[model samples]
Target: MYRWEQRGNLWCLNPSRPLGIVEMIGGGYLAARPQISYRFLLEELAAAGLVIRAWSYVPSLDHQGQAIAAWHSFQHEAKRSGPLNYQISRRPIRLGHSLGCKLHLLAPDYGRDCSALLAVSFNNFSINRSIPMWNILTARLGLRTEFNPSPLETLRLIKEKYVNPHNLVVRFNNDKFDQSYRLLETLQNRPNDRSQILVQQGSHLTPTSLGINDYGHNSWASDYLQRQQIGNFTKKLINWWEQNAC
Candidate 1:
């Protein structure tokens, strides 16, 4: 009864009668195949009566450019005359995981692209921190390797240019790579800010596990736990938005 429809690099889950739409972006590497990497979480949201629009891409060094590209993709689709065109009256909620969180924040919309944003395991790290021995290897190879804005620049940009205040930052207890606290501080310092954080039991990779079936050869205690956490996270997400009704 549930199937993911793909068009180019964008994948969608159109419920029979969608109550709202979720525009999601997954973390690096895994984002290249979001339909499969994020199958479990996306399916849960879809089954809960929400349409899903997940963009697929491999993270590139140019974070800002990628962000712009993603926004345009969604915007262009919405302007088209079809089911993909969300109603003008209701805005969709944007979701991002890890590096995808940075991409969403860097989007050139001033945060007006969605009703609100849900960032899970927000990760903003320098090229050296993100990729082990990156600087050393680059220096030795005489190569120029770095994130376009760099980590510090990213934070500065968010503090100065990001305008939308409605945000929910979720940091799994075990996600050491998450920089939610830092992001929260920046958002809170902004005018008319309304940002919140939720800590739960999970990991950085927890948001990407397929959990395709109860047990499908990849089954293990950790896998089961991941599934449970996925379910838990989904419930919290639905509950939070419904109570706030954004």
Candidate 2:
């Protein structure tokens, strides 16, 4: 069974099992917004027999302070409501999308307890200087680019602390976000015990772009919805937990 509860500004989804995962959504503007990814994740995880709890906090352009506070709150609430098996502590894992990934990568270190991280459609990359004025204007007006923080700082922090040299998985879409190659280069330097970089065909909003219909070779929409893929990912994450935890 699945239950949804409201906790202040956060939405908590409790599954029958104690073990659960948290996913943060991304809103381009400073105002908090909802994305289709959260719903898709919930349905997919539920089908896979895994408990999934999610929260969407107020979005902020102030990437320094409020963002950090929101993440801290997310961590606290997730821990309090999620499965408390002593075994799962050393196996902490996070899945974040877009700006959420950027914020998570900057999260303060919690010692060796923090184990694994998976980033999807992450948008932490330097701005291309060669873009035309019209394109820049359109990006600023259409996508609300001004609200986005410097990807350089986020990338630096991820390189220094976020990407655990022990376990990390990076999933990207080649069609969207041309800077993925550069992002991969930064992640490859880290000494992850097991690191995987998968390039699926799609765009930045692949989770919502392809929908749930066609499971094509150049698409991740199907993979995202696959129970077996979820199981496999969970198993890989659990293996990391077993090896790292005492």
Candidate 3:
């Protein structure tokens, strides 16, 4: 059994005796309700002796702003009480998926607070690539739209600012939108960086626990496959993290 609680926008999942913390940020729209969106993964981590704190937020054009807000919010919660304070005695492991990976990389503290980051399906697609119709509509209206830092600028910033480099960039074998290569390349260029990439056997949403939507709940076959995928991926992630922490 997992102890699940919601502290404002943060979702906390805890075990009776936690070995560590896995602070997470889910992908764009899915993040709006992280408790539901990441339930399976977070619970699995908790079962492996971890405390989880997942920050929930809506996607916005100002990704940088959202990044700062998420970082500060996690920091604030850690200072308050109970399992969240794990960051004080033992640094928490940061986990991010899809667009969530970019937000963690751009956090205000530059990843100094976390022990390391586990980026699953790192995605930094250009505005047009991410939202094809948006650019066309904006161009017709004589306006331009772009992420606050833009895709290229984000990589440039990572090369310059991001501090903690002990990262595991997980890329799927079939995720066409995955940008782990670019992200890992920038990170490895950093001085003393210890970043590695792991190619898994799934797609972009493999890290997510889908419900009725996205055709994930139509049949038992899908359920079995998803559970197997999530289980394998979770074991690989935690094993790598524990080995490195030692």
Q: Which candidate is the best by TM-score?
A: 3
Which lDDT tens digits does candidate 1 get at residues 1-246? 688888666898888877778888999899988888998788889988888889999888999999999988777666652654444345788899998899899999868767788899999988888998888999999998779888889999999999888898999887779999999998899998888898987677777876533233365775776667688789898887766534
Listed in order, each prediction's TM-score against the native is: 0.90, 0.65, 0.93
lDDT of 3 by residue, 131-219 (tens): 88988899899998899899999999999999996899999888888999999999999999989889987777777777432344657
Candidate 3, residue 156: lDDT = 94
From the highest lDDT down, the ranking of the candidates is 3, 1, 2
Considering TM-score, which of the candidate structures 1 and 3 is the better prediction for this target? 3
Leading candidate by lDDT: 3
Off by over 4 Å in 3: 82-89, 212-217
> For each predicted model, how many residue pairs clash, with residues at least 3 apart or on different chains?
0, 1, 0
Predicted candidate 2 versus true structure: per-residue lDDT over 157-177, tens digit per residue: 656665465434445444454
Q: Which ten residues in a row have the lowest lDDT in candidate 3?
A: 211-220
Query: What TM-score does candidate 3 get on C-alpha atoms?
Result: 0.93
Clashing pairs in 3: none
Structure candidate 2, residue pairs in collision: 165-192
Q: What is the lDDT of residue 111 in candidate 3?
A: 88
